[model samples]
Target: IFCSQYMSWTRNYGVQGTIFPAPNFNPVADAQMLAGALQGFGCDKDTLVAVLTQRSTAQRLTIAEAYQSVLGRDLIGDLREKLSDHFKDVMVGLMYPPPSYDAHELWHAMKGAGTEENCLIDILASRTNGEIFQMREAYYLQYGSNLQEDIYSETSGHFRDTLMNLVQGTREEGYTDPAMAAQDAMVLWEACQQKTGEHKTMLQMILCNKSYQQLWLVFQEFQNISGQDIVDAINECYDGYFQELLVAIVLCVRDKPAYFAYRLYSAIHDFGFHNKTVIRILIARSEIDLMTIRKRYKERYGKSLFHDIKNFASGHYEKALLAICAGDAEDY
Candidate 1:
């Protein structure tokens, strides 16, 4: 039951009616607003050590500007003096331009004898549409080479094609119609029941091809006709790695944040922790939908995500993850 609406208000009024007055402000006031927020959050010299270290480079600049205006101090200089080790390194990395992040990731993957497929997957798959477009442009601008060409050279087959397609921003445009969505779901179910290659193809087509908004409608129609949630149906029908792959696609399509919440829960629920998965999911989604993930985590699990993460994991990694998940990743 999602309801969306756009609201508009006009400040001017004619005749005898009273007009709503606009709030007054100045540049100093704007600075105070940002500064007050950081101060209110207790983001002082010591706290900036953690904040700057954990956030991305773009995030640090915003904070630094705010700190300079409000506190009459330099955030980066303070952080340099107070922090050290891995934390300092992360903070310094966050200060680089976005191009630097992409180039650095690529450099790390290609620096040695071979390319890291996981790094390629993590970056290309997780970026938003606009971010990926910007990255493609930036990659060309920074390296004087085609980003897609580099990715193709590093990988092969359908997986490579899929990554490149995503990076190239070539997917179906958004579509929405209750009737067509129901038909698509029926077709999907029939293919799934038959255990044909069409099932996998359709799954990928719907999951990877459609916009999230359109897929949400399709998923709802699927639920109506199938009398079961898509996740449950996929879990029941598929097996082994195929099942995991299908489930990941469906979950990601359904609600990415919810998918992440489940992943976070899975990371620590079993006897031993899948630390890599935890770290990967946290880092990948930290700036994407992590606040939404926290909301979904609370709703689905009936517990504060930070509290659970603290209970399950330990040390600075846990703290960094929690801070990022707490909506401190970046201003953008």
Candidate 2:
């Protein structure tokens, strides 16, 4: 139902971004200002938001360095000390690099007895080969252990296999060729349509191995031949999380912004506040295409994401999120 409706829709992935590196950036000066803001009784949260949200992560890193060198204090540590509750989540999130933050999410996902398999699917399915590679590096560097090893131990069955393939970053790249695209489309059609029993091995190979650009072409070709969206067929054939995960991959390939828009919607409206989800999506996409996402969220949900956060949140947490959501929607 969902994937079919979005099949014809496409979003420009990199056309818009919300956050940018602050102009005339003086990390030392900003660091001193932040220190001053935090020194007194009630923190000047407005100044904190103004300085932190407007600056890019690299700028934040420099500010952290300056804060350390100048005040001989950890910037994130002080922010943690000064801020509490939901707001602190946002501010502390700003201190981490994207992949480093992603590694943190993965660690949390698999930390306890149970696991959030959907989190595994979200990161592995949506990210690029280079991004996956970088996240693996960052995960190892940050956590002092291998991501693949963790996934192997934490998850089982074909689901683990599916995630491992995405983590492997083995998708074929380069411009799409009509000949290969046609062949791949036929392979998928036969594997899903003509055949009966679970062909997940064949399915995973085709879905994970092809470039997204080529897969889009194959999805079109599959529709032309079968008169059915591949995602619809997958839904009919498979059930449960694996089906949902495959659909997510297709949705991401078709329109990544829409995929994330759906994610943001679920995170917000899914039975109270899933703060973890909110923090990850906002922080990771803030510097990327959060503007596009905000626009899409308004179009789809008929409300402002900023307004939703405002209504559902309060205190410094709300202030911090509003700072992130209120960013200029212009190219840097």
Q: Of the candidates shown, which would achieve the greatest TM-score relative to the real structure?
A: 2
Model 1 lDDT tens row, 80-106? 555555444444444545545665566
Please give, for residues 104-160, the per-residue lDDT of candidate 2 as tens digits. Answer: 889889986699876787788888888888899999999899999999999877677
- Which structure among the candidates has the greatest lDDT? 2
Global lDDT of each model? Answer: 0.58, 0.81
Worst 10 residues of 2 by lDDT: 2-11
Candidate 1: what lDDT? Answer: 0.58
lDDT at residue 36 of model 1 (Cα atoms): 43
Candidate 1 has what TM-score? 0.60
How many angstroms is residue 74 displaced in model 2 relative to the true structure, after the best TM-score fit? 1.5
User: What is the lDDT, from 0 to 100, of the residue 210 in candidate 1?
Assistant: 69
**Per-prediction TM-score to the true structure, in the order listed:** 0.60, 0.89
After superposition, candidate 1 runs with Cα above 4 Å error: 1-59, 62-93, 96-127, 139-147, 150-158, 172-174, 194-199, 224-228, 236-246, 268-288, 311-319, 327-332
